[model samples]
Target: MSVGVRRVAKGVGDFVIEALGEAVGEFVLSLLACALLGCLVLVAYLAWSFSPRLTIAGAGVLGLLLAHGAWQTFRTSTKGRRRGLATLTAAAFGATAITAIFLLLYGTGCDCW
Candidate 1:
């Protein structure tokens, strides 16, 4: 209604908009970084999968990386329940990856039957 009141409201609106924009930007950047990292992992997996000698070692390293990433994520997470769940999921995935590597190495020849 009043000129002063209108100005104050406009300033507050601008501040809120700027803050939201920043939050969204951060979220987008994080997503992009995750996507890039996933791509790198996929490339590494492909490269290793093609080589019989490197497959086991590569998978083991990847599993370790996953576990470490999970630990870091858990440490940084703000929500307790989500942190616990994410950590558990990461651990499970890492364990499965490592187990698969071992199985692959122990099972029949690298060449498909």
Candidate 2:
């Protein structure tokens, strides 16, 4: 290939690599978030199994954490001007609400002492 063509191809290759790197970073971050959420759920379950009071307390703490995380996500999304992040934050908020409802219902049924 000519010198100009080689330069153009190199530039295109660099652009593609940068884009792929960003995509992989985003995917890894998403996976980590999901894993963290799963760990939170597991801890809550263990607390519930050990004691009803602990379950209630754990739920309260988890709710607070979720609310804080959602708020932070919202702020970051807004400031960073990312529509996808905003959508993810909205989904997180919805999931938090649903989880709170389930925890409340579960707490009412527990008779552990």
Candidate 3:
């Protein structure tokens, strides 16, 4: 094989590896993901902290996020998903959100908890 072809193949391989590792980290550290992570951490802390109102507000924020995700999954321009799959995924998210709210309202009543 030519040296140029060999170098190109090596470069592509390196890019793929970096994409699987460093690129993912870069994206996670990017503004949007970083801000969302910060919000999630704050919500978690609020839910665990010394006030019932904060915990309730944290759950409300989570419910809002579920609604946003569900809306995103349904919005054609934003979601970029096909109709059938989008409906299926939206339904799944709705089910998951319902189950989560139910659990939040009522304990499992198990000793493990």
Better of 2 and 3 by lDDT: 2
Total clashes for model 2: 0
Off by over 4 Å in 2: 58-113
Residue by residue across 34-89, what tens digits does model 1's lDDT show?
Answer: 55455657887788779967887777876776776567555755655555556666
- RMSD to true structure for each model, in Å: 14.4, 13.5, 12.2
Pairs in clash, predicted candidate 3: none
Write the residue-wise lDDT of candidate 3 on 3-89 in tens digits. 999999999999999879986765444544445445656877766777878788777865666676688665667546547655665
Task: For each candidate in the order shown, give its overall lDDT on alpha carbons.
Answer: 0.66, 0.68, 0.64
Each candidate structure's TM-score, on Cα atoms with residue i matched to residue i, is 0.45, 0.49, 0.30
Candidate 3 residue runs with Cα over 4 Å from true position:
1-49, 78-113
Quote the lDDT for 8 in model 3: 100
Off by over 4 Å in 1: 52-113
Of candidates 3 and 1, the better by lDDT = 1
lDDT: which candidate is best? 2
Of the candidates numbered 1 and 2, which has the greater lDDT value? 2
